[model samples]
Target: MNNIELLKSSMINIVENKYSFKNNGLFQTDIPNLDFYFSSEPTEFNAIIYEPSLCIILQGSKAVGFGEELYSYDYSKYLLSSTHVPAKVKILEASEEVPYASLRIKFELEDIYDVIKNIDTNKLAMNVKSEKGLFFDDLTEKLYEPVSRLIKLIDKTKEEMDYLAPLIIKEILFILINDKSGYFLNKFAMEGTVSNKIVHAITEIKENFNEKLNVKELARLIDMSESSLYQNFKTITSMSPIQFQKKIRLEEAKLMLLNQNVEASEVAFAVGYESPSQFSREYSRMFGMSPKAHAIYLREEVS
Candidate 1:
């Protein structure tokens, strides 16, 4: 078999062995930045936070929607989220015989900055139109080999991991910076771009999601007009700022209710919803169930 085929086989083996118990969810790895995912069957669309990360599917397909754009990635392609964006994702292909399995590596903004700073500026500039924060591209041998090496390190000693993981991660970053899609991400490191400004607003929203957001102030902070901010932000994230905040608030409320068994009203307030009725209405709309019912369902699933 070819190297790509071999890498896929190895990735499937490692994930199936390590994540045998988790059939349709994320499984954390010992590596700080890496996470493994599996799905035994197709899943309905669900809201999720897409952090700055890269993901490669070894066996199945996934569809991620942000605003009007729907991105599909399978074994032949990989997904990249250059910045944090709230999106609805679904497992499009999986079965008992060929389960969906993938690996994701989360990287910090600083990592991208480091890559851009060290690389030649002339080489970085291209005429590519700025796309959304997310991208999908064909898989390449250069990315596959380093990812395979990183997964192999799961069996190594802590001393070896301590010494090797960072080197591998840096290598992956180098590959990403040199890749064609790197242009989508490279704009983030450039200071005066509209994409960079939107990212700034996103960071602020994430940091203070629970507080009431002032759109005028946010636009001023980013040195853009209110209309421009809304248009460009939605273009990149597929959601208006208020919509983004509400998505995060409801997501956080779901976690709090699921983990702590807190009253829905309390959870709603904690996540910045002033009215319990409004929270329940919006929560039901997003998650397809009232908070109480969703929490109970989640509890039953875990039990």
Candidate 2:
């Protein structure tokens, strides 16, 4: 069989025999920078603050998108996010017998610069207008090989694996840097670029999700005009600044409800909602359930 075929076969074997399909959810592997995800059935678009990472599908297909722009991919393609962006991910295909399996390799922005500085300038200049932070590229054999190797390293001893994992990850990053995705990656990694500045604006908003969203202040913080910030923020995140902040607030509130036994009203106030009734209205609209009801549902789910 070809290498790609071999990679998928072994991945299924390792996941079943090694991990035993543990929780049917996100699996944090021993590798500090790597993780595996599984879902037994199709799911709705889950709004999340996607981190910088390279995600590859092993057994099923998926999509990551924001606003009206949706990118769908399977084993034959890979998804790359060069910076943190507000987006939604959905499992398009999966079942109990053959669940959706995928792996993610996380990297920091600084992790990218070392490779960027060493890349050929001519290649670096190829795709400079990275209006969006996310992209889906055809997964060539050249890209698949390192990913296969990364999957295999999950079985190695900590000492040996630690020494080798970074090398393989860097190799993968290097390959992407030389491909079309490099345009987006480099755009975000470079200092003073509009994409990077937007990243800063996003960081500020996320760090202070409980506070009111001030478009003028955020634009000034990123050294851009209000019109420019609003336009580009929507362009990159597929939503306006206020929309992104609202999603963050509600998502955070839901997480708090699921993990803690806090009152819905309490969570509403804590996440910057001045009126509990308003929070309940917005929360129910987004999540399809009242906050208090959602909390009870989570409690029943846990029991």
Candidate 2 residue lDDT tens string, 1-303: 887787678777876676655347778878888998888888988767778999888888987777777888898888888777778789999988778888889998888877888977466654434387777888888888887788787788998789988999899889998887887788888788888888888889889999988899999988999988888777778778898889889989988999887898999989999999999999998878999898888677556
- Supply every candidate's count of residue pairs whose N, Cα or C atoms clash at under 3 angstroms: 0, 0
lDDT of 1 by residue, 1-303 (tens): 898998878877876777673467778877888888888898999889889998888888989988877878889988888888888899999888888888898988778877778887667656433457888888998899999999988778888887898888878988988888767778865777788888899999988989999999999999999999998888788889999989889888888987996899999889998999999999999999999999999888667
> Candidates' TM-scores?
0.95, 0.92
Instruction: State residue 200's C-alpha deviation in candidate 2, in Å.
Output: 0.9
For each of the candidates, the C-alpha root-mean-square deviation to the true structure, in angstroms, is: 1.7, 2.1
lDDT of each: 0.85, 0.83
Best by lDDT: 1
Off by over 4 Å in 2: 125-130, 299-303
Q: After superposition, how far is residue 296 of candidate 1 from its true place, in Å?
A: 1.1
Candidate 1 off by > 4 Å? 126-130
